[model samples]
Target: MELSELPSFDFESIIKSAVKKKDTHPVMDLPVDYEEFNLTSEFDRDSITAFVKSGGWAVGGYLEKRGVMYSAPRYADGRNIHMGIDIWAKAGEPVYAVLDGVVAYSTFQNDEGNYGGTLILKHMVEGQEIYALYGHLSKESLELHINGEKKKKGEVVGWLGEESENGNWPTHLHYQLCIEDPGEPDMPGVVAKENLIPARERYPDPRILLGDIY
Candidate 1:
């Protein structure tokens, strides 16, 4: 049987409900201040790295229309709409869990332009099951926990990866929240223009969980 489409979500409501249950932990150990970058086709890895280095820490918004950066030959049909939030900071920066969850997947994707060392945690918000994918992490992160391992809020989950280990891109964290199960360690961080609506339905903005960092 063909799979039915997933239901849409009111992310704002979900975020409020989750936050009301308990306070969240800091995902990265950086200060509350963050410099936001709006990436476009003109921006490349070198330019972006330079920007981050000069500022110390930066963030990329969810669902931003970007090009070239996600233009690798591996991506077919010009998947330029970003589906996750990109947190840019120094390599080896420790990442923590924002809420109670279980380790769903921890694996290193060796393919070029892939997530590389990635982790996905299963969470519950208002009795609704959701998944959080943390990409571009250090290989060591894969060993931080086994499948089904439970993690508490504010607990150290893993650290950011170096460029060499993080999908061959500049060091950063690709954080995404999916209402539907990805069923694996990986999910598309960008989608084709035509899939934007469904993609948005499937992956809500991560900022809802991360709090105000812009």
Candidate 2:
């Protein structure tokens, strides 16, 4: 289906309502200038968790220096342009479906600085097929079902995973949207600087669906 043909979502209302009703942390309200913080600086998992717990989401990794986190050989040119929005919250916090869809993929990545337990849902909006990815989820999230399971909008799909199971990172949701399936339970959450334009075209800013939560 053409991208323009997809149905529009009430992103603002859905997100605002979700935040108000859930025990969400406000990431954008944090006092630190995340953009200027040294992305490559060494940080312990506990310290990172405490930072997010202090309140607000950290921003400014997209197409920037944060690429060090994904420096594996898989990432071309060691590029670190973040492609999704990371929602900071405590481990075990509930993550809900923003729309009705079927479970496309679910599995544990279990790699260093990886998504860990991830869930991908295949959604149909206005007859256009789209996909949503939720990463860093608890291992329990993978036990709930198998591929092709149907889910309803706002259903509790999973909870945040701890540092041990969530790629050794602080508890947070790595939320991303995709126009075309990447053919794996895992999708590229970050891209190379040279691929930024095309990647953006394929993976548009997830914050659109997330509303003002950023």
**lDDT, model 1:** 0.82
* Model 2 C-alpha lDDT per residue in residues 1-214, reported as the tens digit of each score: 3323334445424443544444333322334444223454454556668876665345433333473466445555676767777766668777888777899999998777789899999876545566888999999988985899998777788888988898878778888888778798987887765666677667755654554442
In terms of lDDT, which candidate is strongest?
1
In every candidate, how many clashes are there? 0, 5
Runs of candidate 1 with Cα error greater than 4 angstroms are 1-11, 51-55
Show the lowest summed lDDT stretch of 10 residues, model 2. 22-31
Question: Among these predicted structures, which one has the highest TM-score?
Answer: 1
Give the per-residue lDDT digits (tens) of candidate 1, residues 6-27.
3446775766567766788878
